[model samples]
Target: SEGKTSFGMSIFNLSNAIMGSGILGLAYAMANTGIVLFLILLILIAVMSAYSIHLLLKSADVVGTRAYEMLGLRAYGQAGKIIAACVVTIHNIGAMSTYLYIVKIELPFVILGLLGKEKDFGGWYVDGNYLITIVSVCVILPLALMRRLGYLGYTSGVSLLCMVFFLISVIFKKFVMECPLKSIDPYSNNGNKTLDPRVMSSHINSDFMATPFTTLMRSHNDSDFIPRFIPVMISSHTAHDCREAKMFTLTPEAIYSIPIVAFAFVCHPEVLPIYTELRKPTKKRMQNVANISILAMFIMYLLTAVFGYLTFYGNVEDELLKSYSASDTLILCVRLAVLVAVTLTVPVVLFPPSSSGFCDKWHR
Candidate 1:
């Protein structure tokens, strides 16, 4: 098939769309719903996401429509087209807003790290609005102007590479580093135990409804593998301790985790456009591209969640990176990588909104 985009490029584009800052929240999700349940939800979400994409591809093939707006038009007439555009526009706007927020919050930290200045510069230049403007002009605007989506494959590839570094760093820190590393002074040795209980916890809050379902297990002890798993509860604790605490309770916290996972897997809007650009535009081929992308994200998500949860069992923070000591140089590098990834991702997200407008104009 003489498709415009190679399979590799297509996978990169889709994967870039699939993986976002939502990965940062997976650890917190796991902390709320124990390691086993978290993995189960992760797998279930991944499968459902992939299946949805498959259905989308099959439908597109049936109607010979490559644009989501067009697909809506075929099924629901003018109303469908308008609704699709509205939905895509709204979703893309929300996603871009998140990336904008990520850039606003992270750029200053990256700047400080580069300058080796811990305290704020005490100037307007360090202000988040100023940083967002600078990034918008210098980084995002140029990419958003590109007329072709294929060119973004390179940026997407680079962005995914940066995320890979973030993932690797998380794994490295989790397994290779000791619990009470003197460098991370917050986690000092306890009175009796060599490690602080806050460092790892076995306690899950009772506020949640507990379940006996078990799927997988991993703990601080590399050699120990136990199947006696219970649903985990998410709560804020002043104490940072690692205990073998297991409580299975279904609460609002578990319900809250769903949006993050859903947000992480949200790439449906980008699917049809990518399909249009694929080298072989067969439904099977597009499905293959999506499957590869989803599988890649699934693995990365699991690894990040498992390692992060293992590192900070019950006391996992909302932002996984926030759970770590800011002073850690290694973490600082990962922070920079995440900053770059999210910044570059702005244009990729902006594509859907722009395309929706363009298609609407052309069709009209």
Candidate 2:
């Protein structure tokens, strides 16, 4: 696999596939859910991502070809081919959908912050060349157009870096750090007025149950009284549905910051390319690449979660930039840059799917 694939390739593929617009949506997931659910979500995603890698490796071993190339063909023949095609197409579509959503969320700010302009938003009509669609196009077409994964060698590096910058910009704020309301929006005074002692005391003294998160949890579970459930059944309920819902939300939150803590656990097909592409001089390097990628992502995600919590505590937005999307310069540059980057990124994702399709026909 060294000369044929290499560890480096795996890293790039992993980064590209896993590191999409998922980052922006995570903060809200964490905040809406709570820390416990967040941790649970993280573990689930990691396990899934790990299993994904294992399955791919196992598939390669069994099929004597890459996971995408023959997993479908071996399992079900031509029908398998169609299913594989759908899987790849769906992945591409999902990637595009995610890109569109994130860009739609991030673009307004980039435009405003950088170019001082705004584009149509999620208010309606997303399919008509929305940001998400455009973003996906940008990420996919250019890279898809490359004709070979080898060409993406450097662009992957930049994407990795961009992911880093994204993490730093969002997180790094656990060291820094809110709530409010009144007829009177106690927080609505525009930040220039002093807090009312009575209100402050009332708020602080209020029951923890009143907290937005607490209220939401109670409301969602419809359980005002917790910790009283049967121990055996706890695993049956909280461990499954509650846990899945919780972590899935935070998995994204924890993705970039605690990169390692979480990256190992994604469930997407993109991880294969990363593992396949590794430099693989030794087991140590292989582990190191995985280790560093996860570590970097962990730190990045942790910070993002923190920043999101601090920046918009009571009402955390999945797309943190939305508030300023209308005038965010950095957001604009990023959108435009990603528009370019995605061009290179999509092909990198599509190749495996295409080859899978060809093999299915050839085998027939």
Candidate 3:
């Protein structure tokens, strides 16, 4: 395809991972740094992404090798070969959370989707690394045997298609379905389990019903109050102009403090890998990829954060995924498609790390 490693892959990666829980992390990110600080952090994160690309380009020029191998030369000299392996391994370890989150969410669904009519795997608890070990043996082992990154090329195309399906479903569902994640409730009786009682109650606090309830009041004036609020407080005219800027406390005594709460799940880490990845090999592509990617990510962040701010801003515990959970059938269908795209792309994002980790562990 034209996009074998082109703009399509960049969009697919950004669409898949840039989203997910990252939007929720950002809700708190804003709450942590405030809107101004949040933007600063975003630019810094984006810079780091750009820098990674710059580093790879420079490295590739020196010894004339791919980014992965270049890391080895930078670190190892003649041992660059070994260093490269270690670098890949370390990268994967950092990305372990992404791997675990995607698998846990998707694998459970697979077992249920294929067999939901027949049975549920919820009861299966073999304990320990038994599951991980088993999966590595049954699943990882086969994929590991593959020859190279090029070997997996076709799957990447499939993953992009899956990503498009995901985008379409969510966008369509948003307009059609009436439920917002906050209002949809399941009933619950046990501490261990429960279902929303919304079905029984005549009253529902639908976001549709609540958006007009009065937007959370941000003061038209931001100058004086911002200094006392937010964690990374700074002197800036922008902060002053941001009327109704939220005032977050910086005191240790403010148990369950707002600034800390905001930064808690702020997902700044995701942009790091993506920025570098795109910069390294794909830097020469159309500028549209960069502009479009930034715009999409920003818009995606805004919609979900608004929901989170409205839904759980003060209560804590990020609301990105929680809001998705609120979406009705159409939304649910979108969620399902997103789940598939994320699951399939797992190997692509995690592969470098997995290869590096396997080699490093093998030597040590």
Q: Pick the candidate with the highest lDDT.
A: 1
Question: What are the per-model numbers of colliding residue pairs?
Answer: 19, 59, 18
lDDT of each: 0.77, 0.50, 0.43
Cα lDDT, model 3, residue 65: 45
Off by over 4 Å in 3: 1-7, 10-21, 74-81, 94-97, 105-283, 286-299, 310-312, 323-335, 353-364
> Candidate 3: how many backbone clashes?
18
Evaluate residue 303 in candidate 2 and report its C-alpha lDDT on the 0 to 100 scale.
58
Model 2 C-alpha lDDT per residue in residues 1-364, reported as the tens digit of each score: 5434555665665556555555665565566655556556665665565555555666665676655636677888878867876777677666555544545664455544453335544443333346556655655555565544556767767776766665554543323321211112233353323334234444443322122221111335664433222111001121122213233343344444354335333434554444455554343454455555555555555556556654554345555544222334454454556544444455555656654545446335
The Cα error of candidate 2 at residue 38, in Å, is: 0.5
RMSD of each candidate? 11.6, 12.5, 13.5
Off by over 4 Å in 2: 1-6, 100-109, 117-140, 172-267, 273-295, 323-344, 359-364
Give all TM-scores, in the order shown.
0.80, 0.61, 0.52
- What ranking of all candidate models by TM-score puts the best one first? 1, 2, 3
- Candidate 3, residues 46-150: lDDT per residue as tens digits? 555445545555555465544465446566774876666665556545555565565565454444444433344445532223444555566555654553433
For candidate 1, report its TM-score: 0.80
Candidate 1 Cα outliers beyond 4 Å, as residue runs: 1-3, 176-252, 357-364
